[model samples]
Target: MKKSLFTFIILAMVLNAFTACSSKASKGGGAKLKARFEVAGMCSNYTFSVIEGRINPALVEASWTNPQTNKTYWKAFGISNPCNFPSNIKEGDTFYFEIVPAEKDSKCAVCMAFYPTPGKKLNIKVVQ
Candidate 1:
């Protein structure tokens, strides 16, 4: 009877472990991808560049890239820096931003301000 009880406990522990792992995976295990973008160029209140092989100003342009998959995504930014208005970025400077799917198909992306430094990872939740 003791042996049977021990076996049952072990099986229960194993099942619990598997359930926990699966739950974490479903939530992406808190995993986020870092999407990288280069500052192709900047214009009046806007920047131009190609992300994920797609031209800028797209209705659904890449606003961020997933580091894990290196995949680009589009998210909307309500407010962004106006640094690019007067053209402050250099030729090869890289900037990161977030994007969201537009309600309607258009040829423009709502990109946030461009950051000269590629320091910490970009967070789509916070616009900076």
Candidate 2:
């Protein structure tokens, strides 16, 4: 009786572990946002523009106005600064991605050139 009880308890734990792992795997990595690789900058710096998905205003700092036309446009958080381009993705390729805030300690060596319409510095994780 004792041995059977122990075996049953072990089996229950193993089943629970398998169930948890499978559930997580099925969920995939959260919602993916569609974006297009717009350009590559010096020092491996890359930028991606949002192709689909609602833009979050909080992620962008300021709006730009075309003086000639007097038309103002608000840049959304979709513009991101992903310093390193993904191995398989190239400029102009539309792909799905998730924006992850850069860790406080994360650091990258890049050129000092100023890029116009600078994007928010965040980590971009490409989703297949």
Candidate 3:
């Protein structure tokens, strides 16, 4: 009987300690990916599915790479800095640009996605 009571007390203490320590980090309250995408596209209000490849910066110009087309565009779509992905982004403040494909069936030069830049700024270029 005594052992059982002591075990219960120890377990209770451990659980309580864990709960208290776990909450040390304060959550700043961030919007989800869906909300972030929607906010970014307030201009065009575009939304798309997740695709392969990471976000590409708008540094290389002239020829854009798109994952959708697997080809390069003659002219880059112009994506600027401080941009975030169209989907699964943390904050709405992140800026994002799409790689304009050269043709109907081609890859976005920046990302090389089959369908690049659904809900994003039309033209965002890397500053010289």
- List runs of model 2 lying over 4 Å from the truth: 1-30, 61-84
Clashes of 3: 24
**What CA RMSD would you report for each candidate?**
12.4, 8.6, 15.5
In order of appearance, the predictions have TM-scores of 0.29, 0.51, 0.22
Instruction: List the candidate numbers ranked by lDDT, top first.
Output: 2, 1, 3
lDDT of prediction 3: 0.34
Candidate closest to the true structure, highest TM-score: 2
Please give the ranking of all candidate structures by TM-score, highest first, separated by commas. Answer: 2, 1, 3
Each model's total of backbone clashes: 15, 0, 24
TM-score of 3: 0.22
Query: Global CA lDDT of candidate 2, please?
Result: 0.55
Lowest summed lDDT window (length 10), candidate 3: 25-34
